[model samples]
Target: MALSKFGFIVTGAGFEPAGKRVVLSSEAFEMIAVGVPAPADALVVARQLASEGVQLLELCGGFGPVWTAKVIEAVGPGVPVGSVGYGPESIDVMHALFKA
Candidate 1:
């Protein structure tokens, strides 16, 4: 997928410790092909990605609740955040979700 200058994509496999081959490039995040387990490392990168102003974050299906929660926690109470499942239908929803 094409990404904006400031956009980035993250998947579950990129967070594996055993598969410590994760890398961020101008193209995309380099990662394992099959499924791999990840814990602390995932959270660490997620935090960094969020801080870097990535416009979109895509999680692998296997990331589960734990990973997503970490992403949310990393995103914290700051910044303009919203769930894509809610549909990016209007600026009102975005404003409502990111109300400061």
Candidate 2:
């Protein structure tokens, strides 16, 4: 059996859940989180995770450019960083639901 080299650090700008564990993809991962409430803190922790062999990093859709940049910088160019975003259709749907 061959398992892919995969790891990630999930951080946030508010509401820390330090040492919390959450299963991501069941067969994929379930990390013991070291949550921090600041992007700067996320950067520091993310760098540590990256050093420990995280080949990829990700952030939630709600994250804006600044947060994304911080994560990317921490993980460095060697690792591919990604962030989820609402596409145009998703945005339209949200607007529809909210009557915006």
Candidate 3:
């Protein structure tokens, strides 16, 4: 089936999901992007998007494997969930960018 709607969740400090959301759309597709302060907040957001008829869900690399799995389970099996992954070459750069 063709994709009509998509949802993406990104994480960063000070990001509030409700206040930091945007929707971009064209004739064929609509994509919703939301920002969360932490990975745990993504669970609620993921379930919300699934109920809102989002066909696919993707998480930023910050979500990582554990949170990605949590989101998938939170959204259940009906919605497809995926996460971004950085290659080995990007490890140092990513670490530097997100270091506390």
Which candidate has the top score in lDDT? 3
lDDT of 3 by residue, 1-100 (tens): 8999999999988998553889999999999999999999999999999999999999999888999999999999999999999899999998898788
RMSD of candidates 1 onward, in order: 11.1, 4.6, 1.1
Write out the backbone clash pairs for model 3. none
lDDT of 1 by residue, 1-100 (tens): 4444232223443445432334345455432222235544555555565566555554543355676667668767543223223335666765785577
- TM-score to native of every candidate shown: 0.42, 0.60, 0.94
Candidate 3 Cα lDDT to native: 0.92
- How large an RMSD does model 1 have? 11.1
Q: Candidate 1 at 8: error in angstroms?
A: 6.5
Candidates' lDDT values, in order? 0.47, 0.60, 0.92
- Native-vs-model 1 lDDT? 0.47
Tens digit of lDDT per residue, candidate 2, span 1-100?
Answer: 2323344445554646342234354555434345565555567666766786666666655446888887887778987777767878698776775463
Error of 2 at 87 (Å): 1.2
